[model samples]
Target: MDIDRRTLLGATAMPFVPSVLSAAVSADDWGSIAREYDVTREIIQLEHGNWGMMPRPVLQAYRAMIERVNRDTSYYARRGMAGDLEGVRAQVADAMGVAIEEIVLTRNATEAMKALILQYNRLQSGDAVLYADLDYDSMQASMQALATTRGVRVMKMALPEPATRQNLLDAYRMAFDADPGIRMVLLTHVSHRTGLVLPVAEIATMARQRGIDAIVDAAHSVGQLDFRLPELRADFIGMNLHKWIGAPLGVGALYIRKDRIDAIDPDPAEDPARTDIDARVHTGTPDYAAQLTVPAALAFQAAIGGSRREARLKQLRDRWVRPLRDMPQVQILTPDDPAMYGAITSFRLRGRTSHDENVELARTLLERHGIFTVHRDGLASGSCVRVTPALATQESELDRLVEAIRELAS
Candidate 1:
């Protein structure tokens, strides 16, 4: 197989033409690649939004980092740790086209998000925090924690589906206006549930105009989606490197506006002026081996070529979607526009108790066909099956997914 691990890692050119993504002939093409990688083409594993499986080179590099660290733990930590972290931060920031000062390494998206949310030192007892109903549950839970424990008001509103960019901006605009007490907003760059891209920068503009802070949860956005932090225009941003970029776990990032860093009180009494973004939020010692692998993932992406991988994934998503779109029983919850979507999508079968049935259906698909997907509810309050495609996912597997769901629904 020319599609060996080395080949995947060594692909260095980016002939990325998004319009090249057509529904036809794609599944078979992707099928061969999946088989070459020993990834099953018979069943779809459309679940990369939660945890992206690592590329072969990334996996190898992760093991190499561990072995290297095991040889001289403290020596590596003290001798080159500072320089290495700086180098990694610079690499990551460059990947996102941001200044190195804007990037800080963190354990995961949750820590990054929490630290950003807590940074709004102006948040008072009567102040309100607004977030979309389609926001990640963990973020919602964080807001709940803030309301109950921090004496702030929390507003979680439903986001309109099949929504346009303006539709999203309207929701946030209304939410902020309805309550002058609203001091902050937590926006999702891409919803983990429906994979609908949000209007982050526009919302950020609205927030700043009103003297409020906005934090964007880019957990599922970083590698899977093409973007820069400043474009989101949020005061703060948090993302996970493990899922999309294939970094080893214990890896994510916090991006804060340089001006906002001063207002943020570092956890465990660290100074924000240090320029070590890691020092600002991640107070505890992280797994160094895992952190070290981040650069490897970044390099691997560069090698396999970002633009090519991104286009291929987009093509896969389009292929998975086309078969189900016109079916009467199928309700596609993800946006029809590529601009409003990423490497993920969601849909549902028309039925009663959609949530329970969707979960059971997902379980059956996995059990019967080796297909794996996550079923979601609560955000927009309907049962929907979430589909995330990784670089390893192939078209034949998606065909099975389309057919299997159709058969089950019928």
Candidate 2:
């Protein structure tokens, strides 16, 4: 099973080469596209928000990389690894419509974000940092760490339930106006808990006008939604490839706007000359095979097309959620606005707020109905079970989820 780097580069470069099964599927058939993944049929998986399952092509590429690296060992590491990584980074940049110099590959979004959060040097004493409760828990802890280690004030607010575009924008407006000392706001492009897509470009523009900086946590949005870097208008962004891009696990990226790179002080441990976007965050040797497979992942995603994948994911979400819309006992957390959501959504059963209650609901869904989902906490309203449908999710599986929710809620 050993594959050399040369073979991998040559094979993935020809993006037209479809996986064996997919080669027979016509352009109009999405079911054939769904067959690319070796998904299990024993249980209906609706919790794809946590981690994406790689398609057969990407997985094969990963295996090939593993074999190549394992066989070549340090010889490959010393010579070919750097160029391969740069190729992967270039693929990431191309996929996002950004320049290669502005992006760097990291182990995951959490690592990328913490690097920016910890290295940012612009915050002064008495300056406040703001983030919503919906931001990633690790990122919130990093913000809190800044409060203790740097002596800056930390502020957090809950996004409005049933969020609308204007209300979401206005909330940030008032928060900035109310606290003139607020120097930075951490905006989650899509809430993992509720799947609410905030108006990031509007919020970023407003923050810029107010002399505030924003670091976007776009861990869930980039691959799920079709957008470019300029659309967000944020100088600093941390995103994950593993979640939506179908990249192998342990691969993600960080973007520091070319002009704004200096705002994040260079890593003190690195050489002063290496002071560009790549120098801002340092994670010791990552899973190189996983990183090398990014190009193949990006290529696979491109073959499917971003808009088509996004549309399919949303269609799956709607298939499950639309049926339960009128269920009195079910409280759908995501708003109805198309602009506000993608594949992720959450539903709370009436009177289910406690940790145990939410966990039980998720457990029952799996144990009784063969549908898998996750329970999420940290909302102002209450706890909920989050359902995230991947592109490969079948209509029958979604219908099964709808039936399960209907029975459980009723």
Candidate 3:
């Protein structure tokens, strides 16, 4: 139960041996790499945006850790778990390219984001806060709560449909210019509803210039995209290891820059004067086994370089999207710009935008085509089905999706 660096590294290093981590990875190489995962034969899973399935090596490591934790019980929890957890924290911090003191593990991104949103001390009476329709539902509710809790006005905006990097930037600039009272803005790095990748750093910079604070929701971007924490240029961020990093479902991290830790109040249970980032979140009795297995997940992702994994996922997305783009009845939610999207994309029938219509659309895809997808709401345009492809997803599955859409549209 006491995990050291050597033991953690040893558990994950040997199992993954991807043939190619380069741009020109061959089809056979991708096939071999796909074999590392154990996906279900019951359906073609295209809803990986919910959470990632642990690769075989990471799954085995998790099972072993679960067994060890059960066997040791409180003996390990009381004696050596703290030290082991610090090692895991260090690993997560290193993977994120941040100092160990600046980040703390949480049960999930929602918990981390709620803590940051509720505890932020910068808001004053009559000040305004901004969020978009595409932000996660829970985060939107949390931002709405600020109106009652902090006496601030809540502002919501809609992103452009055929989004471009320049137009997106212009939208934020216009919003900030229109509302000088806006004190904080919520930015989602990649939209869960429609895989639109925001220019977070630029947007954050614009907010700062207007004396506003930006809280970033990076739940879908951290492992799905190849970038470091610093590149975001934000002092506050909440990200998930379970979504794209391939960790167990209960693991995530909260980040507060070293100088800006004071801007967020500590959890009610902790002393307000305490300066450490750990005081910001208080999750009683977290999943120790899940947390301890984070290194194995990081190792698994490292084996297949981040850039290569990103390219593979986008390739899978483009396969289905390109063929359907010309269809008059199909409406692809995400744009074709390479920098504006990742593995996730949502779409709806041209005239069908109701919740029930999208629900039926998702049902037909599953029942008729044997491909699994989920419907998402809250976009200004309307409800649509979200399709997310994992690293293990085969090109054949995507081709099947394309065929299914074509037939349905006809």
Alpha-carbon lDDT, every model = 0.75, 0.86, 0.89
Count clashes in each candidate, considering only residues at least 3 apart in sequence or on different chains. 0, 0, 0
Better of 2 and 3 by lDDT: 3
Q: Whose lDDT is higher: candidate 1's or candidate 3's?
A: 3
Candidate 3, residue 259: CA error in Å?
0.4
Q: Over the stretch 1-410, how does candidate 3's per-residue lDDT look in tens digits?
A: 12343454334333333234222244437876676679997999899999999877677778777877898889888988788788888888888999999999999999999999999999999999999999999999999999999999999999987788999999999999999999999999999999999999999999999999999999999999999898999999999999899899899999999999999999999988898999999999888889888888887787777898888889989999999999999999999988889999999999899999999999999999999999999999899999999888989999999999999999
State the lDDT of candidate 2 residue by residue for 1-410, as single tens digits: 23344668553343434644345343546777778788888898888998899988789888888888898888988987787678778878888888999999888999889988877889988999999989989999999999877789999998887789999998999999999999999999989998999999999999999999999999999899889877899999999999999888998899998989988877777775766888887788899889888887887787777787778888888998888898889889888888899999998898778878999999999999999999999888878999998877889999998888888887
Tell me how far the alpha carbon of residue 150 in candidate 2 is from the true structure, in angstroms, after superposition.
1.9
Cα lDDT of candidate 2 equals: 0.86
Q: Identify the leading candidate in terms of lDDT.
A: 3
As for model 2, its CA RMSD to the true structure in angstroms is 2.1
RMSD of 1: 5.1
TM-score of each: 0.88, 0.95, 0.95
Instruction: Indicate the worst ten consecutive residues by lDDT in candidate 1.
Output: 15-24
Model 1 clash count equals: 0
lDDT of 3: 0.89
- At residue 45, what lDDT does model 2 achieve? 86
